[model samples]
Target: MDQRSELSEFLRSRRARLKPEDVGLRDHGRHRRVPGLRREELAQLAGVSVAYYTRLEQGNAQNVSVEVLDAIGRALRLNDIEQDHLTHLAKGKAKKKRAAACRPQQVRPALQQLMDSMDHVPAHLIGRRLDILGWNRMAAALLGDMSQLPPQERNLARHVFLDPASRSLYVDWHGKAIDVVSILRLCAGCYPNDPQLTALVGELSVKSEEFRTMWAAHTVAEKGHGVRRLRHPVVGELTLAYETLKLPDEHDLSLVTFHAEPGSASEESLRLLGSWSADQPVRTG
Candidate 1:
């Protein structure tokens, strides 16, 4: 994807979503030819010249300062994630190094052991592009069996968008799909040159209309601790709180673990799932 084009479209889309009355600008009952706030109105709100703002939106501005980006973010009513995305786009690629491929890092034996020790909790390790680098037995039991999937198909985004089982696994499938796309957008800004990521995005865009629409929205988000509602094929519906922990000394690896609330039916279901996972025949390598 062309960085300039991405930046331009993102800004235009954001601008088109807001109205004059949204930013305390009075509508003088004038007929408007354009959607949202006009370029001059946004420039006035951002305390910049209309020419400068126009140049920035046109992707012609060079070395855009953080202050100016922040000002524009405020003018556009961007949230924290959106403001960060604006900064990332406006900062350009001069200071950033590109990764060639979105490959999963080697899973350390100690890390694998630690995950295996979490007998009840469903734990998994994800690398860049949300690839399922490694997963424990409980995680496979809770989610789908990732071990059965080909390495190239082990991405969470791909599973959410392309796999039929994901719709049944996630109780809030639509919300999860949006979150996956937003997280992918955030990754795209961080790793613009990753060939695998580019391929994955292109494939999803072509195959899934939902993915294409969400991708075009240019939403960005970071994975964080949250409650998830999942419907396991065997265990039925479960409400679990998940925590995302960044691995030490690893820039792109994160360990995600899920825990059920104590005294809840979900807790009992998790225990049953754990026992079922243990009873299953282990694959001999």
Candidate 2:
């Protein structure tokens, strides 16, 4: 991807999503040429000259100061993910050489110990491509037959969109699909030249219309606290709160833990599922 073009389009798309009234601008009540605030209006809000802001928007953002970038991000009403993307664009880091191919990251021994200790909570670790590097027994049971997938096809994002079983297993499949695409968009910005990632994009674009549409939106996301609803074949419906923690020394590896809200029926279901998983034989990855 051309960094300049990508940067320009990303900024323009973000700008077009904001409204003048959203950032305290007085409405003129006349038909406007653009959907969002005009160039001068955004410049005024960011406390920068219109010419300078225009240059930045045109992808001539070299040497932009942190203060100026922050101002622009605030003026644009960017969320955490968007703000991070803005910083990446300003630094022109997308032009960096491809990362040296390294062995797939393994779950650390301590992490495995932690997951094993959490008998009731479902926990797993995933790589940048959403491959399940490792998981506790509880998590394994919640996602049936996932371990049986070929190594290359074990990725959660690919399985969710390409495998029929994944769609059937998730109760709110559409919501998860959107989240997956958003996360992939964020990954794309960080690794624009990654051949594997590019190949994944091409495959999904050809295989699923929904993936193609969502990818075009240029959405980005950060892993954080969230809720997930699952329809387990053995345990029925389950609602779980989850948190994702990034692992240091590993590029794009995250440990995710799922918890059921206290005293809820979901909690009861989780207990039942955990018990069932314990009874089943362990799976080899």
Candidate 3:
């Protein structure tokens, strides 16, 4: 969870993905020891000195200006999320490190009621570290039975990486795994000193090679909106549109909901799943 290491790796990974030709630098077909743009090539593209760029890449963001960082980000062709992540890493060193909140996360009664009102939609309130704080019966039906899991084990990343059933559940399990790692990377940048996050990363790295590889890539992401394809054990194939709603609270919790297109086969499958979930015990967590 070293911020310096994270910064350096993020920058290095970004740099390694770019080529001299990508930034209008002519590749003079010369022998090179590495792929992508070299440090000097990146500095030239960013309109900065090699030494200065090297120092910045070495995690020395002390007194670095936003313009300089933006220049670097531009040279790397960073997307919006990547640029935001770069900015977070650069400016994060200025803040004092503090321990992560130790309190257990809980869903507000109002929010829980709101989730319950969505009878057919699958909703889960996800807290920091991708912890599944609260979930509705529909979510439990679509996903697994979270009520049966210990509170500590109800996490999206853990479920994706550790659970064997998750592989078959997600149609594109590799993509799902990458998304989990990217989300965790975003969380890590926001809270570098979070012991729980550190432990989660360590555990996944040791247990799953795919998690380790994706985590090393440092692809940061924000929960927004996307489509999810799943092969449910009971309902067969389904395509669910996922959306995240951020909660206004001390804990960084967001309600994630999945929906199916109206009048589609997926919606019918969802209805069947809802019916199946109705008979099973409702999720209490």
Candidate 4:
């Protein structure tokens, strides 16, 4: 997670995904050397000088203004999440602080209690780097026993990419993998010098070729809500709709809750699973 390199690469990757025609620029029928808009073309679209934009893309620009970032974001057709990521990288380019040491994340008591009270729903508290900081019995039953894993290994990214069980658990395994990589990419932009994140990314990159490829794509996303189809070992196949609830005071923590549609087979299966695992212990990392 070299911040400067990440900033430059993120910009290049974003630029490489666009075409002149995509941005309302007509091609003059001349042979183009690159896949996307040239630097000068982008500079013109952003209403900035070529030299300035080139320096910005190279991660050498100092005192970058938010207005310029906004202009470049609009020119590149970046979404709200992508725009925030770009701004984070751009703002972090001038930092000189050393990466903070890795430490165990603590789950708040109130949050843990709330998750535990959700007896019928699968719920977990996710910390920085998608770490499963705390989980109730239902979550353990649905997503596997996180208590069996080491502290550092209790992460969603690790489950999605490194664990074989996840491939069977998730019907859309590839889509889940893509979402994990995209979420990690967005986190990387925000926590540029996080040592734990650096280690997690390195481990996944080494163990999973798919992770490597997706990481190179530099897609970024902030997961809000989604549907997940799971093939549970005990309950059989079930589809669940999930929503992310960001903790108000804990900026780095989110409570994820999943529920099946009312009166559906999936709902029955989920209830069955919950009833079957009622005695299991909650996993609090």
Question: Against the true structure, whose lDDT is highest?
Answer: 3
Candidate 3 local Cα displacement, residue 284, angstroms: 2.8
- Candidate 4 local lDDT, 1-285, one digit each (tens): 777788788889989999999999998997988788898999999999999999999986479899999999999999999998888888874233333324456887877898888989989988879988898889999999899998878999999998999999999999999998998898888777777889999999999999999999999998689899999999999999999998877767888999999999999999999988986665544
Task: Give each model's whole-structure lDDT.
Answer: 0.85, 0.81, 0.88, 0.87
The deviation in Å at residue 277 for candidate 4 is 1.0
- The per-residue C-alpha lDDT of model 4 at residue 187 equals 82
Ten contiguous residues minimizing lDDT sum, candidate 3: 93-102
lDDT winner between candidates 2 and 3? 3
Q: What TM-score would every model get versus the actual structure?
A: 0.94, 0.86, 0.95, 0.94
Candidates 2 and 4 compared: the better one by TM-score is 4
lDDT of 4 at 7: 79
Arrange candidates by TM-score, descending.
3, 4, 1, 2
lDDT of 2 by residue, 112-208 (tens): 8888788898888878757677887887888754577777776778878988888878888998888888887777777677677778888999999
**CA shift at 9, candidate 3, in angstroms?**
0.4
What C-alpha lDDT does candidate 1 achieve relative to the native structure? 0.85
Q: Which wins on TM-score, candidate 1 or candidate 3? A: 3
- The whole-model C-alpha lDDT of candidate 2 against the native structure comes to 0.81
**Least accurate stretch of 10 residues (summed lDDT) in model 1?**
94-103
lDDT of 3 by residue, 36-130 (tens): 78999899888899999999999998888999999999999999888888888889841443444455678779888888888999998999899
Ranking by lDDT: 3, 4, 1, 2
